[model samples]
Target: MSNIRGFRIQHDSLTEKQRIFIDDFSKRYTEKTKKSKNYISSNRYHLCDWMNSLGFKLSLKEMLYPIISHSSEGAYFTDIDGNRYIDIAMGYGVCFHGHKPKFVYDAIKERLERGFELGPQTVESGEAAYLIHHLTGVDRVTFCGTGSEAVMFALRIARGFTRKKKIVIFANSFHGTFDGVLGKMAEDITIPVSPGTTEGMVEDLVVLEYGSDAALDYIRKNADGLAAVMAEPVQTRNPSLRPVEFLKEIRKLADEKGFLLIFDETVTGFRVHYGGIQKLFDIKADIVIYGKALGGGMPIAAVCGRDDVMKIVDGGYYSFGDETYPDPYVIFFAGTYYKHPLSIVATLASLKEIKRNGNHLQEYTNNLTSILVEKLNNLFKQKSVPIVVHSFSSFFRFITVDPYPFVSDPIELEILFLLMILKGVYTWERRICYLSTQHTIQDVEDIVKIVDESIDEMRSGGFSFTF
Candidate 1:
């Protein structure tokens, strides 16, 4: 296992445990050969079967298909039966380059022999940090294992730097599942999403509607004790809607009121444009939280910002302080997997891939948008399906507020979604498309065709169309 790329995989046979993983893989393959396989042998949310075995309910009905089990190699996805589906989710924009690009896989393989995390820095960490700082125009970075951790750190930095409390987040934008975030989440937040998050760890965080000017107005009168205003430049799950002047005004207000402005670019970072969301709009924030697209599908995250503000992360002064207020001001941020070598190596490889092919990828996304809209609109019209394909770059969400004659609404998009499943296309349960480099013009065409046919079939069955 250790001597991988430095040695080899073909000549190096697997150990008992890994051999078991492969053997179990073989058995699963055989079960796939039979049509009578159980729905899901494993799930993404709960790695262990303990939940189902102990009587918890399943969130989604779709079971694993060819069930290609793996977290990395260019992508982390579940493959149904024998047929391979190009994963557009790419770990939900984590795989910005593609599923397990060769460079990333090779980097991880090489690092295996170099030994893993040593509770210290490695050359790869510097390399990854250099890549991020160069692209984002930030002076320094602190690494962690997930987007939520990065956000958590950003809050600490904000409070420590400003000597204040309270974080301002946006409604409908996702940072990660954390207490600081759950207080104002679009998703269910009353119950703990994860085990460790307690109910009242952070109920003071505020969530404001993103497309509102009143938010800034409210902040003006209510800026006291506020530490940071964190937001996404563009909402990833719903890219069709842009905040326009509202975001710029937020930055202005944050500056005027002395609250740090943090942009959580977890979903829209490296992929939107190499320089990130700020580069596209000519606006800058006080602190930025980057994870998803930046890490290239690795388990790494970063909190980046101005040196003076970040310098407030002085250990004894803020995080581990004698002042003793549990003052969120004293909240120190640290993580075990901060700058893990494997993750850093993956991020470095992924960043290189993005820089090398930035223009081509942008063109690909632009062309894809054109093709999908042109073709899909016609199909939906012919079928009397009122669904509108709202797109931006490689991200899109097809939704219709109105109903069609014997057509599908948002609820009906679910049935329309099944057509996608049969056609070998997968979408988030939220009904948005997270595109990837693996998708081609043909994939777009195929999706349009399937959508048209599915809507027609549903309409024929007396379903009313919304458009």
Candidate 2:
């Protein structure tokens, strides 16, 4: 696997003239951290050393510092820096209460006092399920540790319930990091960018463009053995809002065609509304996947749906259920730490607060976001920049009409991302964002200001933007 050292350099915001400055800053940061921590010899890199040791990709390089440090936080930001920078990406919208939120942590503490786990049953898990059921009006939930696992169950349950294997998904929508749902981004309105995904999977998976009238027509014509039609009604493309009519038609088609409707609200669930984007869209699904900020920043996810649809894995039939322990019939869902009490406790507290406050981040932050989009768009227009501001709750994307990983573009997106990092803000390689409660109107204004400054600075470094 190609490591990130080169990736960082290419993605960094330094022109040849500015590279020396950034390199000097990096060296200073390293030296400062080492002296402060007073590390033994053979360990000069500090956080960088650990990251290099682990070999896992961290945020766009600049984020490496704060993540290790755990800076300003509460129900809002837990910045990596000693100072705060309004966390708009609440773990890409998962940490609803904010970084290491007191309520969540307090709940975890209470649960830890009670004992984190037992033979199997825990009060928090059942309570979490009950609360989830109440919130979504779903009949049952299968607990899992991440968005991908929940989605996998959803697919299997759909197949098992309908006795079908084909899944219909829309263009460029993401479910989880599983092999199944991760392929093909839209190109223009016609061509698509599909990486090494096998044609067979694509064949088994039905692909539809967002508003194509051909969707129902396609399903009507070829929904044979189709198990489910899954989507994030809030399209993950930039703004994350559902085309209102698009959602209604999808629901109509799924019903008429007798296939399951699945909503992968992994990103939008609680952030958009306590009821989720599905509720706002006036649509329903047989299953829904929740993650990102859904676990309030811990690793937990849910696959929930109507009861009749979720009975596929009843008792010990699947390998998971095949345990010979003389226990009552239990669906096999044992990760070494799925439903760890601490996470469940954190979830319970976070849900209570979210239900009470009701996704205030989206509401309070919208005006600021609108201002930002307007400002950024105007600046782009003024500069004739090719970038678009596909804004959503707190996060946004700057996708290229010319994109890659789906296409060949050695003029890597990483470089642009690094430029932003070199400017000092992290947006998770352009995938996720989390917001905190601490951001004031002033902070929002300042963010836009910083963006403008960053743009000008980047231009000085020879970057061009032509609307």
Candidate 3:
């Protein structure tokens, strides 16, 4: 067996027999996965080889090889090895309408036939903007090609509108891959998650604990220099950690302190409701960033805000011909594919479908997720495992307990991930699972069964709580 130290398996407290059992189980699991993925094993090996040759260093846990996808429709996708799995990751929550919904696909197809690349504007662009405005009650909307770009623009808008240098963000609240917002917690300070962040990248950032008094106190003292208080309405990885009162307090402070309240709803927007958690909680934001399910799998994102704030990007008003405009400052927000015709069509189709069935879709998915969480918790209780299942809207997580705190170790999480994938269920590395409108109650029940069996197998293999 491979050294447990390399995998970071912290089972030094386990008995000799238990350690042997775990090692033996790991070997068996390796053999089983290899046998099951024999057909695509070579493909994965070659792909990994190529990646290595190109100087890509991927950890074992990050590698999702031997399970290449072929095609997908609705709630399930077939692998290259002819294996079908219920897709819980759903392209990291982009396939809320499921893989290739007929309406969205047809819209894309129609746009392609007419002409995908025209110029800056398309018929669907105006229509999509209108739909978004009608749904979220935002005065103006602008499109972008990716969530990261949309967020970057939102921050820029906030900075321009408020004319403040500092911005505040909470721990573990991912806005995007943007360098300014990619910081992680280190002791009490926030440091860049990626290495390329310059020395002063976080100089203007006020990183705070979510829902903490320290955050509120800092905002109180430094509100004058803060441009925005940006947050994810529901943190994608840790969804159940919603700070309802904290959000309301932030909104109140933003109103009184002259800072913009920006909600990064990339994952929560269309998945939770037509207007996202803002609608659900009746808390309004000055600017909202949306992506993920916005285009039903197409690459599209929107930055929507009040007319006064959004007008900063009005190049027409800032034209040199307008002599009356004294301060003709223009906040440039542009991309060649800013309003891609295909993306617009897909967004329109997705919005229409969501509007028509949103109530039932949200209710059914939430209920199913609740049920799955209950079943998994019951299994954990039966096994006396120090783990609990929790859900927020349509998302679920498996949280560890005792010595490990609320988070699972990377190795443990990867083992659970592999087990779920082997049992025909797909989830992300964070142990986060999403339920789509396409998933039926039966599908959720099947997921519960697989989870139970996987846990049982792990327990039998000497997996035990350290405390």
Model number with the top lDDT: 3
lDDT of 2 by residue, 1-467 (tens): 43322343445333675555445545644443443233323354443453332322222243233233355465333333342345555566666556777777778777778787645767778787887787777778777789888887788778777877888788767676666665553432222234454555554566677667777677777766788888777666646444778767767777877888888888777767677776666777778887766676688998888776766555322344565443343344556777877777787787787777755655765555666667767766676555566767655665544322313332324444434444445555343444455556665566566666765655564555432
For all candidates, the clash counts are 24, 25, 0
Provide TM-scores for the models.
0.78, 0.77, 0.87
- True lDDT of residue 113, candidate 3: 86
After superposing candidate 1 on the true structure, give the runs of residues whose Cα lies further than 4 Å from its correct spot. Answer: 1-80, 185-202, 314-331, 404-410, 460-462
What TM-score does model 1 achieve against the real structure?
Answer: 0.78
Q: Candidates 1 and 3: which is better by lDDT? A: 3
Sort order, TM-score high to low: 3, 1, 2
* Model 3 score (lDDT): 0.77
* Model 2 segments more than 4 A misplaced: 1-67, 75-84, 183-203, 315-333, 358-362, 382-384, 400-424
- For model 3, residues 349-410, the per-residue Cα lDDT tens digits are 99888788756777777787788788888877877766777778888778877765664353
Q: Which residue runs of candidate 3 sit more than 4 Å off their true CA positions?
A: 1-66, 118-120, 184-190, 315-327, 406-410, 465-467
Can you give the lDDT of residue 91 in candidate 2?
64
The prediction achieving the highest TM-score against the true structure is 3
